[model samples]
Target: MASRKAITRSQAVKYRDASKAGKAAILDLVCAVTGFNRDYARRALRQALVPRVV
Candidate 1:
């Protein structure tokens, strides 16, 4: 199995912004970039948008 790469903070921010383009667009972008399935990409993007507690 291929190892998963960690996304940088900037990339996460990009994803969060791209989400404003709407679900279909964001899903396509995430899947194309990360090679993740629709469900996982959706969940991952959703989680990324959550504010981290320090």
Candidate 2:
């Protein structure tokens, strides 16, 4: 299957600097869209927020 993680980075744009309630809301959205559990969704969003080095 293709990567299920494709959308997390895009969503992370809103995730950065979100309030606690806002983050929870994002997590709920992400979990609903991506079929990832809360912890994995949180980790994916955090990873996506970072600037990757080549």
TM-scores of the candidates in the order shown? 0.54, 0.80
For candidate 1, lDDT tens digit of each residue in 1-54? 122234422245666666456657757766787788978776776676678899
lDDT by residue for model 2 over 1-54, one digit each (tens)? 135566787778788878999999999999998899999999989998777899
The numbered model that scores best in lDDT is 2
* Candidate 1: Cα lDDT at 52: 85
Best by TM-score: 2
Q: Which sections of candidate 2 miss by over 4 Å?
A: 1-3
Deviating ranges (above 4 Å) for candidate 1: 1-21
Which residue pairs of candidate 2 clash?
none
Q: What CA root-mean-square deviation does each model show from the true structure?
A: 4.0, 1.9
Model 1 sits at a Cα RMSD from the real structure of: 4.0
